[model samples]
Target: MDTPQNTALMRALAEVPGPLPTSGVVHISLPHTERFTVVGNHLAQNAALSTTAVGFAVRIQSLPQGTEVGIKALAARFPEGEKLIAAALRELEAHGYLHRTRVRLPNGRMVTRTVFCNHPEALLRPRPADASKRGPALVAAPVSTQAPAPVTAPVSAQAPALVAAPVAPHVPAPASVPAHVPAPAPVTPHAPLPAPEALETPAPPPVTDRPVPAGPLPPAPPAPRLVPPPTAPKAPPRPLPQPRELTPGLQQTAVALLSDLRRHAPELVLSEADIERLAPATATWLERDAHPDTIRQALTTDLPQPVKYPAKFVRHRLTVLLPPPLPGTEELAPARPRTVVIPLQTCEGCERAFRSRTPSLCRDCRTACEQPAA
Candidate 1:
């Protein structure tokens, strides 16, 4: 009979399904039976037991609502079947993949229910495999792990022992060597030769036709004489002052005053009003303080006399005026009209008004006709 431990081991082996072959393994593109098995197994080991009545669960919280399979169907496909299914459900509950809620049954009794939960990580992880058994390949086992050999000693320590020692000198027999030999005397260097006596040298020959010595340079030409410049001529003395004649107007006034005095000796005094009226309009011209009588007389007498004039009538011309615009005239000026020149042409077909300069109809008609021909 098989031992209980051996049977249990066999059961464990059976429970542990072999990893999918590399070629046979299906990529977990979407959730299916194979993917569900792997996920369910992982969740069963990770989740708490009491969360779900089942021992294991494939917490597919990210799975959309109204999915086809239930816990029973998912568990049936896995190796451990119902046991793994219970575990998977518990794992899914623990990981928050599925939520548990209390609901009233049709019979009026309240019961705990399981539903898929929403989580970003659970949705992104590999999905359960389909019934086709397609998923990614399983990981391979590790290779051997043997220990390495010990390291040996360095060459420096062993070099001295491997080397040989030096040998002593050997002496030959007398019969093989020379009989009587004189000992060599000590060597000494000879004295150096005596130096020659010093001799007197003759003086150099005199140079011919060389210029005579400059004879003290003739006393340096009596450094140039520094004569003083000629003095400037003195200016002539100025002339003495001379008297000047008076202006005619002043002379006339003086004569009139003297005549008045002579004619009326007893009443020589003039009225203040008459004297003020006779005064010149410009006071600067008669100002004795600024210009003395003598300087004034000299200036007035030297100046050219003024000409006397009599008043007379003269004619003046009038300037001409331009005429004003007439009433009801137009406000804006008319614009100039533009002139355009048209080129003359001879058409290949009609040859009437068409001009050949631009080849308008000939080129266009040819292009249009060529398309149909092509």
Candidate 2:
């Protein structure tokens, strides 16, 4: 089938240097070999249906029978969520692609039944002659068999043929199908028949807002008790640490440090009574392993010129800026050195056993022996 020019053109198109730039959509449609559903263009290109509804109809058509298509199932399967999926399903129902009805099971439980039509237009087509045997007739009088005259306009001018039309009560077929044309029936002159305009149009069916359950309604749930929320209690203020007791040596050190503060700051001169009264607070600091120079620096550094009350300033600093106590002695103390016992050896001169690096006399014996030698 290839000519020289056609082959060159095909080769050029096939041998694209790289991806070609495209402003609009470029479809690379491939034939689906598996898991494909045939959706008609009526549903796909419907102006009334939303994009979500079209996509949902395609997905539902592709799904295997008995698979869960419930709102929750769809919400879990896709990210659009239940509300949008429900709206899309309603759209499908309104457009004749889907129908949902309630059926009472043999076990006395009610369940929803769903019916899907791939080609919705077939529903409006003429029914077969045996359709009347199936159920009660929708029309009270015999249906007229006369065919409607053909219109000269195109297909779009006429109403679309429905697929899977609901079973009606002895309703006659529409005029669309030419194959079902029947011969005119003989009429008697005694009675004149009514024209098509004179015949009454069937009233529209009643609107059912929701499917009613067959059994009695369940009892109403009891009203919930309203319990008051518990009130939060106010928090109490934190307590300060109690002044620590100190040993006699620590107390003397504290008093000495306080007395030496004047050496650093001459204005920080405290009297004997003042030192004695503030000794305990300083001793508390010392008890917590506070160094002497550190305490002196705290009490003397940055002294206010001509301090009217040095004792009060020192007391306030000592109380407000007291350092936290050091960890316990067990934690702060160094690990103890391992004790090694030396083997006892006999001394060469004294013939007495003594502990030493080499054979030697004891301390007292060595001193005595060395004194005799000197």
Candidate 3:
């Protein structure tokens, strides 16, 4: 090499073995293929990624894809987790080691997909190849057309000018006559042969109506009667829903609130759709955005001495004593229509209700469709 520096460096690099730690993560229990890259040589040590972040990254790697590893869950699980994890992720993303792509899930949810890299070159994503620019297809060259030159014969003294052989002139073939053709039978009028006598076919023996020994028919299953399914007895209709009969949709919302409470406070088991007994109180709680558990607590916390009929009593309390709405709730309420009417604008894509007046996809699906991939 011309340059001494290059020569020396090449020699030094040649002496040094490629990379360190040939073995992969020895822990066999790691879920999925996470162990393959967890401690691989590809994980370059970035100073920005502190010990905490590195720990967090390892934890993240071990987690299954699409798991709910939110900041809140991390904080609850580890000390100083939220801040450390956030900073670490931001640092890794800056170095192109981490990627967050908002992908539309098969279930129609818009979610961020986390793509982690052990070693990222930070290059732009490759684009699809251009069809027009493709190289020509492989094809064998055309076979040689001219016949081989005539082979030379041995010459006597001086070589003679080569004489060519003459080819015979082409002859046309004569038209062919039909094969095995019989000559016309001389147009003779011959006498007809005598008709043969008809053979007699004996008439089939007449089928006699014979008596059959019939046993009694099998006792057919009482021709299966279509008995309607037995339904659970419906509770008496709740007092005609008063003047303000809650719509089916609103009742569903109330029931959902009850279900949420059941998650945290399993003892609060009640049908979400038992709207007659639960709607007014549940609606009051939902309007304020009060956590279901908190609302349940408020209803059950300071009960009067030995309360009878817990469901009836709880319902009464929730309706009568609802906490004040959260401060910013007024702003949120404007987005909801004051008087519920069927949505005017339907989504052009899914034809779902609550599309803006101009007729577009609802917010979630709209974001999913319009979001530019990263």
User: Which candidate leads in TM-score?
Assistant: 2
What overall lDDT, based on C-alpha atoms, would model 3 receive against the true structure?
0.57
Using all chains and alpha carbons, the TM-scores for the candidates as numbered come to 0.17, 0.30, 0.23
Model 2 agreement with the true structure over 124-220: per-residue lDDT tens digits? 5555543544565364543446533333334343433631223336778677757686766753344443453565567655444557789985654
What's the lDDT for candidate 2?
A: 0.74
Residue 204 deviation, candidate 1, in Å?
99
Residue 224 in model 3: shift from native, Å?
69
lDDT of 3 by residue, 19-92 (tens): 63467632223256534544644353656566766766767776777766566777887787566777877666
Backbone clashes counted, model 2: 13
Q: What is the TM-score of candidate 3? A: 0.23
lDDT for 286 in candidate 3 is 64
